[model samples]
Target: MAIDDSLATGQRSLGDPAHDYPLWPPLTSGCPRTSTEDVSYPVEVDYAYDKADPAALFSPVRARGGLERWAPLLPPLPAPGLGEGATPLVEIEPGVYVKDESRNPTWSHKDRLNRCTTSAAVGVGAPGIAVASSGNHGASAAAYAARAGLPCVVFTGPDTPPAVDAFLNAYGAVVLPVPWEARWPLLRLVVERLGLHPVSNLTTTHTGHAYGPEGYKTVAYEIFQDVGVPSAVFVPTGYGELLFGVWKGFEELRRLGLADRVPRVFACESAASGALHRAFAEGAPAAHVTVGASEAYSIASPVSGYRGVLAVRASGGRALLVDDRQLADAQGELARAGLWTELSAAAGLAGLRSLGGQAPEDGPVVCVSTSSGFKDKGMGTHRTAPATPTWEEVERRLRAAGIAG
Candidate 1:
């Protein structure tokens, strides 16, 4: 059950019986692969840990960086630090806090993921890293790869946000905007032919990079450190790496005797897909849902991974779905509270709101806002007035708008 690789015990597949694999090279081709199949599935990393002495981890030296504070439990890989972790937990209401992940180096939660996945590339001796994303993921991967001095390639859909395009270019990543269906095949080729480390999903059912979610575990650790375990955590879910990682982190804490119990983790997804929601409703092993239009494209994953389902079921959590209307309302609420989150990032808040009177009656609630507003696909779609008016006219306009009434 345990294969030693530093403090990391090993990895295992999500299937029944949980097939184990050695820790090195990440078992990236998938765990327990048979000659009869060629598809790769998700696997989880197992850590060997003693009861946690929180003081040992909370020292001044370790307070700054992200997951590096828990290096013993993670893969032994060199970090290309871009200040990806250690984001703020700001309380916007009486009993709810927003874990603002946009404060990361790349202005999104994907920075946490890339830091781990890119380190995996370094650990595995890969020349570069490749992923299929035009949003936060690609930009973050490019940034981390640049920091690591590795070539980066991003396969995105053609209608990528200009800000994201600029971000990828700034980090010197080669971007290929092709058909949506073509991205995975191209990414697989990048992994197979060029030996680049693939960080995103390239499988049938969305088994994401094993190390990527390790970065997300730090979110839970940081939350526990700041506010203790909340009653529940609402996370914007795509492939569910962040959801699973946060749950796993809490699991580690409980295993290490740091917390009394793990919090209920909520998977907040766009109603357009709601893959995890469908899976849970159907009691299926994995998510399979029809894709539809959604403004929160970042988390509207057509295929949901078992990791998310496992996180929800294991943590006694629920999967909540929100439409674009609810997403916009949540975004407005966050903006009013001085957190300008992307539509996708607001899914967590929307999910929390959807709870209505059914919300748990004990403990604080934490909603993870994943990225900045600028990452929204309609970033600059608003109109502005020309500045040809005099001060008097401006004041008149302000009065007319009721700003200076």
Candidate 2:
């Protein structure tokens, strides 16, 4: 794949812009200046915005290539993509919308991140790519690495979702189901010894791949194009990469003089581990918490990232925590609205509903549905009993289900 003449200038520390590095050898580790400290900061890709043409960059005409369409604002994408991005903005209610990210090639928003992270692997000439994920991230990494024709090793928990397990194997990825605490260590060793690029977090506080979140920025761009600047964007956040990316994308639009204001970006997390919310409560840049049992497995992250704090604080947004009951209710609501989302993915809507009637009323609100319900754990375990074919049985079943005659 040809590299775009991307306007990406360099990488900078999120904590301090004084510490800058070249775009090559993307700092998989957190910012070197702060890594040894208690809280390490993540690095972000910088673009030469002064040189970018707002007209050409924000053109309404749909482009063919995947994230490459926003190449000017993105890091150089050297790897081939699997048609990620350009997800639908579904209007489930009058002034509310759902950015259904399941429409992506891999049926999750992680497709957007992996497309760029895998490209980083190719650009750096790494032998393969590695990730530590519960489900969606690993599946996405495998698909993109396969598309790039590179080997992939996914480090997952022992109880990997059946659907995601199938996805990993279908992509021919080497799946390693290790203890949750051991996956990151194994991933670091793979990167150091095997020369595989990592697409997931390595730091104690979750400073993920520099290029990964850049891919997520496209969600904001698409939202801007579809409905202008929304009043708020609620994101189902784990490490906060997606929340940060959405905030950065809108900030970029405002910087380029394309939009007047950026929206309040909400980070919605599972109450089982509301890392971001906890961090905010303690006035910390990042924090870690003991993860409890939660059916919303994807967003029940034990650690929160500094990137998420930056996004929420900068956008004047709030981090809301939703419990399993709230998650299930939101999931049921989405299903009723004709959108099937993972229990974790419904965190966004769950957060919105937690606000009662206090949701922002200035403009439209968007709850980003991060993945499909098919990716949920124990998805294939349900067995539907066969019903009798008799008219009496059918009518009785219909009546039991509250169906009218």
lDDT of each: 0.83, 0.90
Winner by lDDT: 2
lDDT for each residue of candidate 1 in 316-402, tens digit (9 for 90 to 100)? 999998999999999999999999999999999999999881346789999999999989998877888786569988998889888
Error of 2 at 36 (Å): 2.8
Encode model 2's per-residue lDDT on 1-405: one tens digit a residue.
357568888899998889999999888887898665578799999988999998987888866548988888898889988878888899887888999999999899999899889888888899999898889999999999988899999999998987889889999999999998899899999988988999988887889998899999999999998999999999999999999999999999999999999999999999899999999999999998999999988988888989999999999999998999999999999999999999999999999999872446699999999999999997999997888999988888899889947
Q: Specify the poorest-scoring 10-residue window by lDDT in model 2.
A: 352-361
Give the runs in model 2 whose Cα sits over 4 Å from its true position: 357-359
User: Clashing residue pairs in candidate 1, if any?
Assistant: none
**CA lDDT, candidate 2, residue 183:** 94
Quote each prediction's TM-score: 0.93, 0.98
Model 1: which ten-residue window has the lowest total lDDT?
31-40
Q: Which residue segments of model 1 deviate by more than 4 Å?
A: 1-6, 33-41, 51-53, 58-62, 357-360
- Candidate 2, residue 267: Cα displacement in angstroms equals 0.7
